[model samples]
Target: MKPTITITYCPKCGWLLRSSYMATELLTTFADELNGVLLKPAETAGEFCISIDGEPLVDRKAAGGFPEITALKRLVRDRVAPDKSLGHSDRVHAKPDSGKDEK
Candidate 1:
């Protein structure tokens, strides 16, 4: 079964918009890989967490802040579609070492 992503955010903290935006990005990027994205209103104050199948993937308080959209997409993609390419959302790696003497 495809994984479902849950974005649990504190409505009291006005995180609904943030959570919804993340949901949108995840849905767009992993349309085929995900079952669906759930936007949940957190009961606890200042709570913001992303979960997959009830397993916590990220916690805003623990992480010190929210993750950027690209980071969040990468996290979801890694779990739902390990081999999937995220195109511009992907990280840029350092150039490969070239076996040539420095001039």
Candidate 2:
């Protein structure tokens, strides 16, 4: 199975500042973008600061400011699906139908 990873984000600015890519394939696909922002793998296990266009996007010390992160997680979760044939084992199963849950 593909490695399970966590992605953290700011809840205010709608910026996607941090993500974890445990799978080599996923990391390779996102390497360019991660490198563009200087996003590297976490070393210790604490929040890290992130910036874009010289503007502060994430303040790991502060409380609010990560709406961007939340939105990004939602977007990714809603958009990407794993390919089992490609040796990708991680799967986000579709939510089962429930009459009251239908929108």
Model 2 lDDT-worst window of ten: 81-90
Give the per-residue lDDT digits (tens) of candidate 1, residues 28-93: 888888899999998899999999999999999999999999888888878888899999888677
Residue 89 of candidate 2: its Cα lDDT? Answer: 30
Query: Per model, how many backbone clashes are there?
Result: 0, 9
What residue pairs are clashing in model 2?
10-66, 10-67, 11-66, 11-67, 12-65, 12-66, 12-67, 14-68, 15-68
Candidate 2 lDDT over 24-70, as tens digits, reads 33345433333232334444445545443334444555735333443
Name the candidate that leads on lDDT.
Answer: 1
* Candidate 1 CA-lDDT value: 0.90
Give the clash total for candidate 1: 0
My TM-score estimates for the predictions, one after another, are 0.87, 0.26
RMSD of model 1, in Å? 3.7
